[model samples]
Target chain A: MSRFTKIALIGLILFPFAFLLMLSLGKQWPYPAIFPEQWSLSNWQLVLGGSEGLGNSVLVSVLLSLSVATLSTSLSFWVSRHIAYHPKREAWLSLAYFPYVFAPVILAACLQFFFIVAGLYGTFGGVLVAQLFITFPYGVIFFSSFWNERLRSMEELVKTLGGSTAQAYAKVLVPVAKGALMTCFFQLFLISWFEYGLTNLIGVGKVPTLTLRVFQYVSEANIFLAALASCLLILPPVALLWLNRAVVFREG
Target chain B: MLTIKNINKQYKGEAVLQGLSFTLRAHEMLSILGRSGSGKTTLLKVLAGLETADSGQLLLDGQDLSPVPANQRGVVYLYQEALLFPHLNVFENIAFGLRLRRRPETEIKEKVNGLLQRLELPGQARKMPEQLSGGQRQRVAFGRALIIEPRVLLLDEPFGALDAETRRSMQQLLKRVAKDFGLTAIFVTHDLKEAMLMGDRLGMMQNGQLKIYGNRAEFIADESTGALDEARFWTDLQGLKLTK
Candidate 1:
């Protein structure tokens, strides 16, 4: 590989371990160096292995991520397929994104407010409703091209071969779109997992996500603990990236 | 048998066909020849029930096929691209129609096997469309369209993707298959050589109508005239207004 690539490879390897070691060591820095003078799992325990029953936060994040990704991707799949064939498809797509692009946070607030007015307030269903629009746009963007160009041809071909539109989509379109679906799911999941402003703003303190816990810890001057929480927050995404390195290699 | 009479179409206030008409007998391989955007493919779409005509009537087997849906019309369309489903294997692609009707497993296997053999794709039954070469993919498309036993086949530049040799071979294959299966096919092309070689009778489309049509000798006779004559033929075929 080239020199730049080599340096990037080296940086990728060393950066994570260096930061994790420093954070675990708390304030015990070595003299005139970035290395910690002392290293221990005490802070790791103080933040990550805490007896605060963070299990709830973990469960909430994982569940919300999974549900949001699934809901958004599913919605976008059918909508994108139908809209892809529209005569003025690009124009209509631009219109669909209007709600998404213009003040998404504001739109989420309006949706949240509407949900409260409709008596869905403080409910799990209400939180999911708020996240649908938040996560929906990404899935639409991701799957729209696939449906229009790649999957559209495939579906039509299958249709000619005697498959119904629905069968064609379920059988051929979905399989060819597997890569896109995976990417959409991960991206949407990540969005829902890391969202602080919307989740905190809309849920109105009724529900707690991992991001809420992070900020809660951050304001108390527990910088190391907060960083540890951030690290913990980063793990699932990093693990997901590692698990699907195929997608990363392609994206890279 | 398929018959189109006085078929008229327009796009954005522009007329494509003005009283265009034709008759395609069973097992007759008829080719529609035209320059680009001469409404040849549009006519094929109208014949296949993919597009509606502004005015005129289409009769298939003496019944009005205008109201029929594309799939139910027994009108199979082959795009310039083979358009094979990327997710499906060769067998699945070829067996698409049978699968839709819920054909028996033994029959599907037997028919698809026959297709694989006929198309010289015997060992590629499990391979996806991406794995096949351009020629291989087109052959598979041909087999898939034929296996359905469509009453009328509409091809839109079906050999446009193939090399010269492959196109020649496919043209021959189509001729034999169209005769053997009694398929009334409306093949479209803009190439002079392709149109002559593929069709039993060729129709030259210009503007919105078939203007120059006949057997090989007739088209040749028209071609022997001056370039201006040929240009006039195109103009009359399309009903274009000239600056003269």
Candidate 2:
């Protein structure tokens, strides 16, 4: 890349984080001043030191994101095989995009009746199922490209080598596909981490994720706390994005 | 001994293999020559159970193998492209079959190392497939398939991707490997010289029909096999007027 392009990209990334840091530190600096009148780490202390139950919110967010990512990635890895190999795979893949086209909040509202009937309303399971409808489509699209003639030849190689079905998957398919699986896991994790609308409607305000807590503070007009929570939510995804770039681009 | 009786295959309502029948003697390597789209690959796929024939009987040692699945067919088909497992190193790719069979580690190591030496790739045990040349990668694939002790090895233009020098050396290596292992093999190629060099018997296919020759004299003399046409072309060139 050109030097100017690199500088512009770095500036674009750093400018937002710099503003968030300023907002999280300054107590009040209304108007005309280009800089904060005064700054302190008091808000950071409150957010990080468990005074606002931010620690619990972070824990809940991490656990839910981990579960959702793990379940969706694993489920789709196997399920995509059937869809990819089907004769009508193109038609089926187009249908798979239906749930994701609608807004997540609208979809959650539409599915709330089923959740209530299944006795999952106001529970973590309800929220997880709702999130699944969003993340599983990503997995399907990501994995659909995996089934080509090369993979078929590899599978036939296994069978002719006296391998069974279980051995073909365990020995060949999983090992070859490991890199893609990791990429999918990290992406799904980030998706669930930043989600708010579905969780709020389904968790019924009981299961407070970090995103929900950030919005709550924002509504109460607590700029410092909201900025701090937003920073927490944004940092991991940024780190993961950088890691993914390194992994994919370096290999190619 | 292996026998294929009246194998028929169709694709998109077109006949790719029609009433194809041939018997391969024990330890015999049959080289098949055909024009492109002459169904050489389809025959191999059916023999390897990668594709099912519409109707056929495949017999090994007088027992029908028509009902067998691809994995249980004991037939290995090597492609024109050496499709080695990219995630595996040279030794691991060769040892894949043994590992799946749960062979003892010592046995697996001894067998793989021995084959590596025979294929002249001993120093490449730890190297990935991407790190090897085209010829070396094809050798590794050969070792990988040979280690399984398959009933029939079907080679589909195995040296088609190599440079001329590499192709010659690989052909020599394969000739030695087949002889040393007493392997029953079917070699397919569009190159007449390559087919003649590799096969104990020769066959030609055109428009999904095959004709095999048990004798080399008849195979070379047959006009439809193209060998006589090649000879006639050379003889006719000798009669051209000298302009210089």
* Two-chain complex of model 1, DockQ on C-alpha atoms against the true structure: 0.38
DockQ of each: 0.38, 0.73
Task: Point out the worst 10-residue segment of candidate 2 chain A by lDDT.
Answer: A243-252
- How displaced is residue B169 in candidate 1, in Å? 1.7
lDDT by residue for model 2 (B1-244), tens: 9998999999989999999999999999999999999999999998888898999798988878878888888888899989999889999999998998899999999999999999999799999999999999999999999888889999999999999999999999999999999999999999988999999999999888889997988899988888998888877787664432
Candidate 1 displacement at residue B17 in angstroms: 3.6
lDDT of 2 at B92: 96
The residue pairs in collision within model 1 are A161-B97, B16-B208, B206-B238, B207-B238
Misplaced by over 4 Å in model 2 are A1-12, A25-51, A242-252, B241-244
Give me candidate 2's TM-score against the actual structure. Answer: 0.90
TM per prediction:
0.82, 0.90
The single-chain TM-score for chain B of candidate 2 is 0.96
lDDT of 1 by residue, B10-117 (tens): 888999777888898888888777887889877877776667899999999999987876667778878899988766789988888888888999999998898788
Q: After superposition, how far is residue A201 of candidate 1 from its true place, in Å?
A: 0.7
lDDT of 2 by residue, A137-177 (tens): 88988899987888878888898888888898899998888
Candidate 1 at A206: error in angstroms?
1.4
